[model samples]
Target: MKVDLFTLVLIVFALGVCVTLVDVGTLFSTAEATVTDETEITSARE
Candidate 1:
């Protein structure tokens, strides 16, 4: 199993997009949030 630099960068970028989506999802979510999730949203805003 081998990966080139371009492929690694793509993978990292994709993961970051996924993380950003999750953060936004949590922000718009109406359900109860844990302290950790709240802190994550707060930090993401700053």
Candidate 2:
């Protein structure tokens, strides 16, 4: 099997986009969890 330069570039770009999207998603979920946890803690303290 053989891949040309253009094909390789496309594959790399696709992988980069996927990784970036995953990172953003993970950051959002983590932030949401932290906020929820803080709210629960505050409510409990009240």
Candidate 3:
């Protein structure tokens, strides 16, 4: 029973990590898009 509980804890931890990684990736992607848009606008003005 102890072993089963330990395994459950590990699985939950792993899932939390996976969700955090995905959120980080999404944030980075949004930042990149915003930068690209700003660059395009600046170039157009010039």
- Candidate 3: where are CA atoms >4 Å away? 1-3
Off by over 4 Å in 2: none
Each model's TM-score, in the order given? 0.58, 0.82, 0.83
- Candidate 1, clashing residue pairs? none
Considering summed lDDT, which 10 consecutive residues are worst modelled in model 3? 1-10
Model 1 alpha-carbon drift over 4 Å, by segment: 30-46
lDDT of 3 by residue, 1-46 (tens): 3579889999999999999999999999999999999999999999
Candidate 2 residue 19 C-alpha distance from true site, Å? 0.9
Ranking by lDDT: 2, 3, 1
lDDT for each residue of candidate 2 in 1-46, tens digit (9 for 90 to 100)? 8999999999999999999999999999999999999999999999
Better candidate number, 1 or 2, judged by lDDT: 2
TM-score of 2: 0.82
Clashing pairs in 3: none
Q: How many backbone clashes does candidate 1 have?
A: 0
- The TM-score between candidate 1 and the true structure equals 0.58
Model 2 clash pairs?
none
Residues 1-46, candidate 1: write the lDDT tens digits: 8899999999999999999999988876644467668889999999
Ranking by TM-score: 3, 2, 1
